[model samples]
Structure formats: C-alpha cells, structure tokens
Target: MSESTLTSGAPITQLPDDYMQNPHEVHHMLRAEGPVREVRTPQGLKVWFVTRYDEVKTALTAPGISKKLMGRVRHDALTEHMVFMDPPHHTRLRKLVTKPFTARRVEALRPRVEEIAAELIAKLDDGDVVDLLDVFAVPLPVAVISELLGIPIDNRDEFRAWSNQLINVSTPDEVQAATSGMADLLYRHVREVQAAEPDDTFFSALVHATESGDRLTTEELVSMAFLLLVAGHETTVNLIGNAVFQLLRNPDQLQVLKDRPELIPASTDEFLRLEGSINIASFRYTTEPLELGGVTVPAGELLMVSLLAANRDPERYEDPDRLDVTRPVQGHLAFGHGIHFCLGAPLARLEFDVALTQLLARFPNLELAAEPETLVWRDSTLVRGLHTLPVRLA
Candidate 1:
C-alpha cells in the first residue's frame, strides 16, 4: 500500500508519539489501514510495519524470508548469531547455543541469582528512595550473564556499561563506538581465556565446540560470544525494570503479588504482555512476492514487525490497554514467535519472578520516588525501556 493511503496526520517514517505513550491508537490506525503498510525508520530505510497479529505471525514464520538478511542489509557491526540467519544455519547455530540455556542449566544458577538480588537489596537504605534500575534491574541480568559466561566479577561492570553503550538506540554513533570496543574486548578476552585453559564455562564450551569436529570459525566464535553477552542481558534488564516500574505505579497489583506469591509466575507473563521490554522486532526481509493484509510485499523488501503493537492487538487480547495482573497473556509476542523466539525467555522469567517476589517481600512499602511521567525512557526504535526508575524503598 502507498504511504498516502494511511492517514496524512501519521508520518510515514518517524514513530508517532502515540506509539510511545499509548501504541494501541496507532495499532488500530495501522490495522484499520491494513496489515502491511509502508513505513520508514528515521534512518530512511523503507520497511513494511506488520501490525496485525495474524499478519505478524505469517511474516515472522513465512517461508523464503531468512533472518540472515540482517547481515546483508546492514553489515556494519551486528554480525553474529542465528538472530541474523535463517533455517539450516539458524537451526544449527541455535542448537549449539541452546544447550547451556535449558531450564535445568539456567535454574542451576538460582541460588546465585537470589544471592545477587539479596545483596543489592541489602545495600538500599530502608525507607530511602532509590532508582530500581540502578539498584536492581541492570545489575541482576549482568550478574547472571557474567556468572554463566565465567566473566570475572571485576569485569562485570565494564561489560554492562559496554552493552548499554553498544545497544544505545538513541544515538547510532554510540552504538557503533560500542560495537568497536566490544569487538576489541572480545578478542582480548577470548585469547586470555584460551591461554588460561579455564574449566567448563560457556566460553570454554564454545572453544571446545570450535575445536571439535563442529568446527566453528574463530570469527564466528567471537561474534557468537558477543551476541550472547549483549543480547543475553539487555532485554531482561528492561523487563525487570519495566515490571518494577509498572508495579510501583499500580500499588494494588504490587499488594496482590505481596499477598499471593504464587501469582509471581503468571504476573510475570502479564507484565511481559503489558509492558514487555523488547518493543521492536528484528528486521525481516521478504524473499519473494507475498500477499498479506491486502498488500503484496515484493521480493527483497524489509519488514519491521512491531512486537509492541502486536502484543496490544485488540483482536488478540480483550481490553488490551488494561494491565490485569491476573490476566493469562501466555501467547503474547513479548518473546516473539516461531523459530526466532527468545532463547533466554525462561531465564528472564525466572529472574523477574525471583527478583520481584523477593523485592516486594523485602519492601512492601515501595513507591515511586518520582512521577511516572518524569521517569526517562531509553529513546530507541529497537528496544523500549526506562533509563531510570526512581523509587522509595519504604
């Protein structure tokens, strides 16, 4: 469909303000306009924003299209993992990486994860205001990923800082600079670990895979490690931060969790649905002409799926705007759909469940230190989350 077909009030390239505050209005507009509409990023990349649930499903799992197109389209820095690959290659790489992220594997770190959270909470002054993001959200995921990858505790801070800089959507130059620094760090760290001949860690496991008949290239290993380290924690940090922010905004829901801890698991799902951290889908390219939402996407066009919009699609969920703590939002696209679904989803859920449960139990009197509108959010079209969530521990 032509750009003019949609409302002239809605710009073709830039994301509208309604998308930031209440995206349902824009989703309704796009859905009414049709499923696949011509949109462009601020960078001026022409893309088809998939709005409807059924159309998003089709685009994500559609044949002919491959995740590998990411490298083809923009091969500047993000040159790693099955996240940018498709089918056989994606399948193989995902299998190699998935071995260590299994429920048993991730759950094995529960005690350590809880210890980290407890330590963080202990540092907060009782009845004193604190930024949940600084005190909890950011560190929890960094610690978990660092421990899993055998990164030295001393280096954890550096890693987290670099990851944030690398994924900074507000500025492309910062992302590029972070990419270069991360690449340099990756090589140095890989060499250091190789020389040390460390015990069984995720990095060591990857080294073993490379040495074995599996034969992963050195470049591939480096890229894979970077991908895992960055992608591993970024989304989860936002998820935890977003959950705490939402709960603080709605004290009734916080009390609900405080009263019945059993709801932690279900509430985690609902939080992801309502304010799911990962807001935007990765760029998907069309392999051939395909009909969707009454528009045909010719071969080789880029498709940008709005995961945030799809999660709030009225057709999929009743009263999509309301945040019902008890709602069963199991099928939400927060972690995405199909083969490219998040591999670390289970671990993220576990972290949120444990962190929030323990957090509320520790500080039942928690409240926002500042108004919700005052809280600053990370301004990136890719991932959506708050930069800081000020709160009072009282």
Candidate 2:
C-alpha cells in the first residue's frame, strides 16, 4: 500500500489501484475493520470514508457536519447550488423547486417519460450489438431533463462531456474548464428563459417562481439550472444503465422481472440498493470535533459517505451482495438520507420504471455483449456507473 500526505501534514492511506472497477471487496474490508476509515481518493484528496449504513446516516444528518464549501475547494458556478448550502439557505432554495419534483408532478410526467423511452428504444434493432450507455441510457434522461428545463437539445453532447468531467475524478484544471463551459452555456440559456414570457416549463417557473415574494437570483438560477440539468439526468442515466447491467449479469433475476413486469417498479429499489448511481455523496466537512462510528474526527476535516457501500452493508440487509429483484429494500442510502436526499429521486424512479418496462417488453431477449469481467466502471467517486454498457438487443 502507498500513502500520501494531506495538507495537514498527516499521512493518509491511498485507495487500491483497482478500487473504481470493484469497490465492494475494499468496502467489505473497511466495514469489517470499522465504519469509518481515513483514505485518499483516486483524485488524491484525503477524506474520512464512511462505509457502514448506520454511520453513513449519522454523517449525513449530524448537526456538526456541514455542506458549505467555505473555500475548502475552489468555488465557482457549480458551488452555488443548494446541495452545498445548509439550513435556511438550503431550505429556501429547495422550496422554490420542490413543487416541480413532488410525487404528483413526477407522476404527471409519466406519459411523456414513456414516450421518450419508447422513442429511444425504437432506434435500436434486434440482433444488434451496441453500447447501451451511449445509445440509450445517456440520451433518454438528457432529452427528458432538457425538455422539462426548456433548454435547447442541440447542446446535449456538450452538456454530457462537461457533466462527466465535473462529476468524475478530474484535476482542478479539467473541473475548472467544465465549470466555465457549463456556466457560460447555462447563463445564456437562463437569460433567454428569463427574458421570454412566463411559461409552464420548470425552468421558466423557477425563473418566475416566488416564495413569499422571493426569487432565485441570476447566479442562483444558473447554479440551480446547472444542478437540475446535470443531476436531473446523471442519476437516472446511471440508474437505468446500472439496472440493465445488473439484470444482464444475473439471468435468474432477469427472468423474474421478464415474467413479472409488475415487479419493475419495486425492482427499482433493488437495483438502486445493489448499484445506485452515485457512489459517494457530495463533499461534506466537519464543523467541529465529533465522534463518527466511534472515531473522533477533528474540525475542518473532509468526510465522504459511501452510498454504494452503505446500501450493501451486510448488517443492513441479508445476502446484500446477491441481486434479488423481489428483495424488500427500505431506507437504503442510495438516494441519500436527511435534508440532502436527492430532490430528483421521484423523477429518477419514474424514469427507471418507464425505461426498464419498455426496454424489457420490446427486447425480451436482451443480453450483455461483452464478458462481465471486461466491462469498465467510471473512474468517479461521486458517480458510480459504467463507461459503456455493451449489450445485444435481441
């Protein structure tokens, strides 16, 4: 094993070289050792990695922990969103957009979501080997979110590239470039929407949305748009991708879903529990010294909650590693817990249900095109998904 020195001059353990490809083994080791372990991320940042389910919930909701960036990392347009804010600020920002993502609103979007999924699936042909991630997973959510936000569809490819760089383990330079590019594009788009007549689109409503006569500022709108556009699609993209990948790997589980299509909605939680999109929750820091999983972490230290690890914790679920579509999953940290729980959860679930239902019905014999061991996972601590999910649509 290798070590790296943090800015505090303390030695930190580096993650295994193959950590991204297969993190479960490492997570199993970490959970057994203890809930919290200090380690260096693939990007070379040191963090207190929370592995077990119980400790993860504590880290997420503890009053002493903070989401405020506070200059710990470079601040830019991306940092302006509610995910980085705490309390009153987070509350206010979330309130403005909450109505649009409510269960009723999301359910109302079902037909449109189904239409988009069907349109994408129609492009594929039987007996064709294709990168499912590229042709299906990525575009479906991108199109849905783009239309909802009233953003033009012409720049989706650019949006995907920028979002990938921002979400993945990129250097400061890469992140800055992506941040600048996305900020520029969204700023212009937001301005266009702001100047136009009020409309029913979510972005327009957000621009015109008022809570007690309060509205999002220009910078805030850009940041919120950035969050919605990127996160709005990214999570669902991986959710669909990971679900299909897991189903392909486990034939028995796949057959269960094929035989009982009604299980698809319930299976969404199982897929999320097994391999939800985001690996680690976003960056969080300690406000003061606090005990986490019996380990005392100092103030001003970085902490990361492993959503991926927490969901598969043996103590939390029986046979956690096994992919059982019928498993009753509840309180999984896949969508996170507490105030920062994903606002897009409802939409993501709806999209998964539509995507998988149409997908399986249209291509009942779908199978993986590549060997299981050969697939590559994205090199990202924040996002957990594949670089490509090659599959045969038969």
Candidate 3:
C-alpha cells in the first residue's frame, strides 16, 4: 500500500481495489482489528470509516453526527437534498414529505406499479438480449416516481437526465451545472404547479404545505424534489439491478424463487443484505470529539460508515460471502439505521417485491448475456451497482 499520507496510525486512507470490488476481506480485517479507524482520503481529508456492526449501530444513533455536513468539507453544488440535514431541521423537513413514503402510501400505488412492470415485460421481444438495468430496472423506479409526483410524462426524461448528471461524479463545473439545472427544473416545475390549481400529487402536497401554515421555503421544496428524483430512483435502481444479478448468479436459488413465489418478500431482504445497493452510509460529521473502538475522531470531522463493509463483517454475519436467498437478514444497514433510516424503505420494498415477483415469473429462464466478471461495475464510491446489466430472457 502507498505510504500513509493523511492520518496517524496504520495506513488506511487509500482503499484497495478489492475493497471496492468486494470488501468482505478488508471488512473482516476491520472486525478483527477494530471498529472505527482513522482513514484519509486521497484529497487528504481525515475521515473515520466505521466497520464493525455494533459500532456502526451506535454511530448511526449517536448524537452530534448527521448528513448535514455538506459544504462544510466539500462545497459541492449537489448537496441540496434533505438527507444532508440534522435534527429538528431534519425532522421538520422529513415530516413535510414523510406521508408519501409511508407503507400505506406505497401500497396504494400497487396497481400502477404492477401495471408498469407488466408494460415493461410486455415490451420484451422473444429471444432478444436486453440491458435489464436500462430497460427494466432503471425505468421502473423513474416511472413510479414520475407517476407519484405527478411529473408530466413529457418531463420525465428531462428530470431523469438531469438527476443522472447530478449524481455522477463529474468535474466541479459539470457538477455545478448539473445541480443548477436540476434546481432550476424543480423550481420552475413546482412554481408552475403552484401557480395553477393544486393537483392530487406530491408536488401539490408540498405546495399545499406552503399555502397552509407548514412554512416550506422554495429552496427546501426544490431540495426535497431533488432528493426524491436522485436518492429515490438512484438507490432503488441499484437495488433491483443488484438483486437480479444475484439471482442470476445462483440459478438454483433463482429456480427456488421461481418455483415458490411466496419467498419474494423474505428473499428481498436477503438480496439487499448480500447485494446492498447503497455501499456507503449517508455522510455524517462529528459534532464533538468522539472515540469509537479505541480510535479518537476529533470534533468537526467527516466520517463515512461503510454499509458495504459493516453488513459483511464476520462478527455480525456468518458466511458473509454466501448469497442464500433464504438467509434470515436482520440489522442490515441496507436501508440504514436510526433516525436517518431511509424514509423510502416501504416504497423501495414495494418496488422490489413487485418488480422481482413479475420479473422472475415472466422470464423464468433469464440469464446473464455476459460473463459475471465481464460486466462493468458502476464507478461510484457511494453506491454499489453495475453500469449495465446485460441479460437475455431465455
């Protein structure tokens, strides 16, 4: 490994390629050694990487840490989402939008979600190879979000294109341009909806909140819209893609699911645990000097809990490498933990359940078109997913 350039103690800044490809090995090392370790970024930022399961649970619930540390460390223009906020403010912000993400709300969309799944499946031509990620996985979530938010059918493509640019790691200027473009789109769309009569949709709800005594600022509304578009779709897209890839990799397990469909819900959790979409926990900054697992992380420092690493820690899970669809998964940080737990968990679960159930039932003989090793992984430090999932419905 390269010489430790940033933090004290063992060399930790640079994560090995294997860590990105499959971090189980390094995670084992962390569990055996310690939970919280001082790591340095290539940019020389001193950050803490929480590795063990219990330690992560504590850190996630710990006071004085949150997703609101944006611009404090890296002043990126893409940090407008509510995921980057702390308590009272975060709670207030979340309340305005929480209703739409509740289980009942997501469940109410079942008919539409099932219809979208069927529509996508119906479009598949027999014996033709398809990039499932692009055609099936990606569009499903975007369409669902568009329908729920009442985004005009014509505007969905623009929202998607802008969201992709905003999330993809690009140059500062490019990131800024993407963020500005997304903000402009959301501001304009919300304003137009507000100027007109309110409709029965999420954007309308936010407008109603504003019209009432809720007091949601224009910037906050835009930020929430940005969050729904990016975080809402981006993570679910990865989850569906990852779960499909895992099932295909283990045809026996796939056959089992195909044979017995009742296991879809339980299998979804296992799929998330084995092939979690969000690799990194949302960003958190220390409010005070915090010591975890014997390492001291100073106040006002940036820290990233590796959900990818934590879930695979041998101390918490047995046979961490195995992808048994039947395995009972608990305490999985896939959706996250604590007050900042994913608000869209219910909706995500519904999408996965509906999408996966239909996907397997429709294309029972689905197989990867390319070798597993040949498939390109998305080059993202934040999310774990493939750039493309090429498959053929056999």
Candidate 4:
C-alpha cells in the first residue's frame, strides 16, 4: 500500500461550521490543494478523496472499483437495494424495478406532482412566514413517491419520521434505532403485502416482478421497498429544498426564473450542480491497484468521490461558483454516472420543476423569513441539505 501525503488525522471533507453553511470553500481547497488527497474521517478511517470532475467521472465507472461490500459494514445498512451491489446481482435487482421508474412512468406522474405542489402551497397560505421545507419541499417529493409505490396516504407522517432518522441521523444510537425500526416496519409492511392478493401498485409489481424465471425473494422485496421509500424521496427532498433555497438566496436568478417560469426545469440542473443531495456515491472497493489523479489507490481500499467538490471544479465549469440557472448545466454528477446512475432522476427533475414553478407562480413575492446565518443543515457526510428553509409569502 502506498503511503498518503496527508498528515495523519487531517480531515478530508468534514469541516467546520462555516464550511457546512458554505462548502464551496472546502471545494476550493480541494481543487487548489489536491485533486486526489487523503484524510481521516470523523470515524478516524482514512479514505481517498477524488475532487476533480474528470477524475471523479473516471473513478465512477472504473472496472477496478466495485460497489459490493468488501469490509466489515453491515448489510442492514443497504436495506437490500441494488445501490449497494456489483453487477449481475445489481443488474438483476435494478432490472426488476427499471420499468416502473422509466421516463414514461415519471412523466405520467407530472400532473399529480403539480397537484401535490399546488396543494402544499395552498396549505401554507395560512401562515405568512413558514418553513418551506416542512410544508412544501419535503412533503411534495414524499407524497409523490408514496403515491407512486401505492403506499397508503395515511401512513405518511409515520413513514416520514422513520425515513428522516434513517437518512440524517447524527449519532450511532440513532443509527441503530433507525435501522432496526425501519427494517421492522418495512418487513411488517412486506408481510402485509404478501398476505393479500396482488394489485397494480408498484409494490405489488415489485413483489411479482420476474425475469427469465428469476423473482425477488421476500428479503429482496422488502429491501427494494425500503430503498425506494427512502432514496426515492430523500434525494428529491433535498433537490427541491436546495433548489428553492438557491433561487430565493439569489434574487437575480429568482426573478429571472419567475419572469421565465419555463426555466424551472433547467434551473433544477443548476441547483443539482451546486448543492446535490447525494454528496458521495456508496462505497466502492478497489478490485485492483489503480492510479487515480496521480496517486496510487491500492486494491481493496475504500474510495469515495466528492460530487460536491467535483461539480464545483473551476477546471470543469466556467465561473463554477456562480449560481446561473441558465448555464448549460449538463454533465454534472448530481445523479451520478455509470451503471448505478440514479433511476429516479426523471421523477426528481419533474417534481422539482413542478414544485418550483407552482411556488413561484403562487407567491410571486416570496422571500426568506429567517437569517441565512441561523439556518441549520443536516449533519450528514454523504448528503448536503438544509434542515429548514423558512420563507415568507405575500
């Protein structure tokens, strides 16, 4: 194994309070200092950081990097989804759910997504100053995913509570509790699903999905539901929330988008480029020793890419730090790359586009209700998002 140039215990991506509020500083540091660097995590384990766009893109699809578990990590963490698998198994698991998440299926939900976004706006009308994350950004995506999966609408509150802890938990105890609780709840829901006759719901389709005589086992089915319910909405929750946060913070951009409402879809791409919900891809174990960004990454070592840093690399984007909704924003690694590219990108884009458009149309005078300094962010290593976005509508 090659030794790292970084000093022992030096931090990689995890940073101070200010950096949490504005991570572009860290991204700048990553870009200016070392595109391929190493540092100790809060957990004290050292890992390689790929901070440049070209290097990150190459590493994402590298043959020597496999997404399958290669260490002491628990399987319960993946929730039995394809996001954690290498191909053949990953391909099989992803195939069962691919048709349901195709562009057509997501497009079919756009009208309903509009309905949900509008309803959420109407509900927020009672309060002049409100937390948009609570009333709009969070619920709109959850509602869409829940409805898509045919989950009963009444269970949303409970589902959201469990889902939040799983995605943003800040402690080890919270992780154990959230993991065990979600596993139990989803398993029970799966049993309930299997005990009944099938229907046209996505959950039912997953339960019955077969290919060349292959079918999802009960464990796999539950894991699939758990993955969809969490990943399906979590990333989009941040996607929409982060987008609205960006537009509101950048008034010039906000007014531009408001005047040209059709730009909302394109704006989502810019927002993803800026503050993508997923900061790092799932862990990839090296299949063979590889050279990455001038450093030798030994075989079997765990590696992670900083999508946050990569998307902001000045070498990859002109004026990369500026938030331009109209920038030609393709090729950003917001939804990731390679065989594991996000299955829900179409759904997420549609939801954000609808939500931002309806929000701007309904409250043309919307403004921030809280000081940007006081806003809190979820303390997550793999995702970047605000905990709440308070706004005023007039």
Clash number for model 2? 0
Residue lDDT tens for model 1, 206-295: 665532356455676678777777777887888888888887777788788888988998888888887788766877788889888778
Tens digits of per-residue lDDT, candidate 4, 1-394, equal 1233445444345444444556667667767767676654545566777789988998888889887662246666335678778778888988888855667666888888888887788776734888888888878888888778766547676676667676663576876777787777667777787888988776777787788888888888778877888888888889978887777789999999889998888778889998899887777778898787787788988787888888988888898878999998879998899898988888888888888888888888888888787888876667788888999886
Best by TM-score: 2
What lDDT would candidate 2 get against the real structure? 0.88
Regions of candidate 1 where Cα sits further than 4 Å from its true position: 1-14, 17-24, 73-78, 153-161, 170-172, 195-198, 210-212
Taking all chains together, each candidate's TM-score versus the true structure is 0.90, 0.96, 0.92, 0.92
Candidate 1 accuracy as lDDT = 0.76
lDDT of 4 at 349: 85
Please give the RMSD to the true structure for each candidate, in Å. Answer: 3.2, 2.0, 2.4, 3.1
- TM-score for candidate 4: 0.92
Best by lDDT: 2
Ranking by lDDT: 2, 4, 3, 1
Candidate 3 Cα RMSD after full superposition onto the native fold (Å): 2.4
Please report, as a residue range, the 10-residue window in candidate 3 with the lowest summed lDDT.
1-10
Candidate 2 backbone collisions, by pair: none
Could you give candidate 3's per-residue lDDT for residues 71-178 as a string of tens digits? 564553346556787777877877777754566667888899999999998999758899998889989999888777666546656666666555544567766677
Clashing pairs in 1: 67-84, 365-394
Q: After superposition, how far is residue 240 of candidate 2 from its true place, in Å?
A: 0.8
Weakest 10 consecutive residues, lDDT, candidate 1?
1-10
TM-score of candidate 3 on Cα atoms, chains taken together = 0.92
